[model samples]
Target: MADKSNAESIITETQKRISNAFDVFDHESNKTVDVREIGTIIRSLGCFPSEAELHDIIAELEDEEPTGFVRYEKFLPTMTKILLERKFRPITEDLLLQAFEVLDQQKKGHLEPEELTKYLTQEGEPFTQEEIDEMLSAAVDPDKNVILYKDFVSMMTFDDTR
Candidate 1:
């Protein structure tokens, strides 16, 4: 089944990344780590779990003892599920480009910094000025005439490990 295949693939890839991350915390390679390090291990794998999720994980591990070692194997299944359920996955270039296209009134492939800033901060979940500044710094063309949106979107969505 297609649904089953998707789950299997996601589990397989997440397992590999999680294993790499767990190995870093399991310094002794014992496949076990302190419950305190659970949050660090999840973040190291690039999954941005919320404080509530992190607390839940720590609590789950603390069930047998207030603070104790957690078998990495016990976490592989749980981590894969968390990864699948995470909402803040990386954005795609196509979606970004489509948004830009709507803003490009004149059908220009680029946008002025001011125009881009207004839409970014005034619409949707308004981005902070600092976040806009950081994004624009690498996104703007050298001449500073306009933002090549295609290039900008690509830079934002890039993930080497993918």
Candidate 2:
């Protein structure tokens, strides 16, 4: 079903991100990143966890040496799961509708292309123009030249990786 493919896509995306993050943060290329590197990685993602919170996160990971280092191969899945659940879990229909309402300032019941672009490129983790274009290409209704709330929600939730 669509849900199964979506889950697979999510897993695949998470794994790719995790691998890239590990490569970026593992400065020494030791196949592991230290606790400090871990904190830096988290901060790079626009999240700032307290020292205690960071410690708790590392504690949850099973480390062979307990040296405050995360081995990419050993901990990638856990890291991906944590990132997906904490930051990228699927949005609920009600939440999506409410967000659409907020964005649809004129209560037009749909978003014009410009409005959608603005929303996508808003401050804090802004999307690139290419990304916005790709999203619009997928979500926009060809006949309407706009994105209805339902279509937007479905596009946002749909994952094609079966």
Candidate 3:
């Protein structure tokens, strides 16, 4: 129940922020924001993507409209992705810690290999056994057969090459 309420509040707040951004950037009142406006929006959100990166982002939106603009509805997903990836790193790390705490039932600050597998497959957002095995192989300490809280958080927050 509490989790549900928190999720709802997050969604509501995200919608409010997006709406506010749309209002600020949609200069022509055409319900779409131009590429120039997008650059301003991205900067306002505190992400300073390089000129090439910004050009690439704008290029991706070219197909969305003939005028090379993105409608507010269409822009929300991109905005959300950027905010999550850049502005919310600390929040992401904190969420990972909370999840680790749930699995560390005895407050031992680490999980036995088997406990890690069980938690991954049975609890929230179940992953396949193969996925769990791969994750363990990548980050688990072989001699101890346990994954420390720090290692687990590091693994979760790792930036994939892709």
Candidate 4:
């Protein structure tokens, strides 16, 4: 049987792999990541945790503030749940790369609402035009079609009703 130290080491190594997977999906090239981006990353990994799954994970994550935004300290365990829920089995780096290519539709290193909606709909989880409009409203300036990385990250990080 594995010793306690060995088990801890294994856990650390698994977390490392999960973190690397997240790095691949952090399209803004920023260290700070967001949950919608996380959802895309999870889908890329061949898993689709429902909204309920994400809510439960977020609820359990330490450092959730009264306002409900997770602090950087809580981000790792929260992301770990998305990246390594099915055990420490190795996830392919190629898959991560492919997922990035898919998500980076504009090749701008940030996600646009239209891009996200199209991708989700392609996967059979459609987002209505109104939902797309609302999501875009959060990130885009009125009459603007482009989304800055900072705004995009903020929108992706925050949980929304739509």
Error of 3 at 41 (Å): 0.8
Task: Provide the lDDT at 64 for model 3.
Answer: 46
Q: Write the per-residue lDDT of candidate 3 for residues 73-114, one digit (tens) a residue.
A: 667777777765554222356778888898787999888878
**Candidate 1 lDDT score relative to the true structure:** 0.78
- Which candidate, 1 or 4, would have the higher lDDT against the true structure? 1
lDDT of 2 by residue, 33-128 (tens): 876677666655434456577777777764756886788776676676567667423446677789888988898888888987876778556888
Best of the candidates, lDDT: 1
Query: Could you tell me the lDDT of residue 130 within candidate 1?
Result: 89
Give model 3's TM-score versus the native structure: 0.47
Each candidate structure's count of clashing pairs: 0, 0, 0, 0
For model 4, the run of ten residues with the poorest summed lDDT: 153-162
CA shift of 104, model 4, Å: 36
lDDT of 3 at 13: 72
Per-residue lDDT of candidate 1, residues 1-162 (tens digit): 999999888778878988888888896789888877887787766665566767887776554666487787778877877776764354566877898899999998999999989998888778888879987888789886689998888776646253
Which is the better candidate, 1 or 3, if ranked by TM-score?
Answer: 1
lDDT of 4 by residue, 1-162 (tens): 469889788678757765676677666766555655655554544455666775666566534354433344466666555444563233344554456466776677566656666675676657677767786677665556655545455444422211
For all predicted structures, in order, the TM-scores are: 0.55, 0.47, 0.47, 0.39
Error of 2 at 118 (Å): 2.0
